[model samples]
Target: MAEQKNRFPLKRREFVKIAVSFLPAAFLLPATARAMALVRSPVRVNRLRPPGAVPEEIFAGKCIRCGRCVEVCPYRSIELLDIRAGVFAGTPIIRAEEIPCYLCMKCTQVCPTGTLQKISQEKTRMGLAVVNRHLCYTWQSMTICRTCFDVCPFKEKAITLDQLRPVIMEEYCVGCGICSHACPVTAADGMKAVTIEPIYSWE
Candidate 1:
């Protein structure tokens, strides 16, 4: 037993040196937390808040995470953010590519916290749809595809045709994402020719 103990020398000293090396990191933890709290996550394409949602700056604080909006969605469009979303965890989000908001306006009525304010279907502005001309078949003159314009809820008001190619009108667009979901031309990255971008709904 005594001989076995001698196999390791200066074990306590080595541990102490390693412990001191991590001290600086420990002190930085508080500052890192503060910085993270101050910085809001950047708005991602295709991921959007439900219609009538307040601005991003105050959304996290105002939301109560009741899951009411998710329960009332007829199309199962709204989903709560998971813990990985940091401070915004449990807030409602719509992944437009997977299931576009049908604009039934049911979610806005069920939000007890006013996180999603009650609004008419025509007034909903989730995000703006931007078209990637490079990936569009109609734009490239490869084919005459009218899938986006046909699928749009607002029809000619939101999306019009110029020489058989789709043109997105920004002012009349409510960003329901139906056009993005129905787009047939998909790139290697899984992005459709049209995709929704954050347009600050309150604006």
Candidate 2:
């Protein structure tokens, strides 16, 4: 009975310690929020731009918020940004999971503003596809899967198998989002084994 009484105080003390430890984090939360707000950081980490987009600098200045690109897209892959996008508001974006661009290149034709440039499917550079080896069946040697390779528009050119495992040839990848939407792993695990990476450019 005496020991049981003593145990209560120790548990109380540990609880107090944990509560005190959270004080620093609580204080830092406001500063972190402010930093992010100031930066106006893009919400999409792998935010794939519309097909045939020019360099970020040139595209930003040229895009006139015309919704023609959004209307012409058959797959509904392109979406215009809302007010929350800061200076990039009204720019078109493609979230690969929702709808991958079919590489039809129709969006460019209707653009009154030259934000989405006129480029061939073969020359378009939306982004790259990187395989998550940890989640990939081929790299884990658990099973042979080639969904990404099979769906690639530039199959032999962009993706090929080495030792019966998939390899993404970055140079040839158009970042069209086909492999990202077609990935079999995302269906089973809710995590994409192959996903699109937005094209990054220098300022």
Candidate 3:
């Protein structure tokens, strides 16, 4: 009984030593985390919406971020905006380089709210595909690549080749983003030669 009692005080002293060892780490943990967070870069999002999505002002107000649009996307093209997006946080965005919307029309059908109205392919009007002639292989006559024309859902009306130069018919193009995704050249800025621009933009 006396030996056991002697051991108890020794164990208590060991526990106090271990606890003291952690004191410095505990004090530094918060400061280390804050420093790491400060060094981290912010996420950049496309200020654009999916097909059949409402206007930018209305979209910011209506989208509930239920992730239904993200879930139903067949091409896995949809992504939820980060908290860094400010007023547009949790909204659906599509980065064409990652995976562009193929216009299957499934996301619109699954939206519980009318934020994304179920519209037919012909009426999607998500955004227009703009080709940077300087970056296009066909425009430079470097290669006979008809990637954009072959992939367009509305090739006859929205896109046509004149001497192998693909032209985007703005009025007919629904801005589905398939052309941009199919483009071969990815610029240094991480953008494709052909890109989908919001239907309404500063340009």
C-alpha lDDT values of all predictions: 0.86, 0.79, 0.78
Model 1 has a clash total of 0
lDDT over C-alpha atoms for residue 28 of model 1: 85
Residue-by-residue lDDT tens digits, candidate 3, 1-203: 89898768667788999999999999899978766654332222323467788766577668788999999888888888776556666888887667777888888898888888888989877777788999998999999898999999998789999898989998888877788878889889878888877754212
**In model 3, how large is the Cα lDDT of residue 128?**
79
Of 2 and 3, the candidate ahead on lDDT is 2
> Against the true structure, what is each candidate's TM-score?
0.80, 0.76, 0.73
- The number of the candidate with the highest lDDT is 1
Best by the TM-score measure: 1
Residue 114 miss distance in model 1 (angstroms): 1.0
Which consecutive 10 residues in model 3 have the weakest lDDT in total?
38-47
Q: Can you list the residue pairs that collide in candidate 1?
A: none
TM-score of 2: 0.76
**Clashes per candidate (backbone, < 3 Å):** 0, 0, 0
Query: How far off is residue 164 in model 1, in Å?
Result: 0.8
The reply for model 2, stretches above 4 Å from the true place, is 1-45, 187-191, 200-203
How far is 162's C-alpha from truth in model 3 (Å)? 0.9
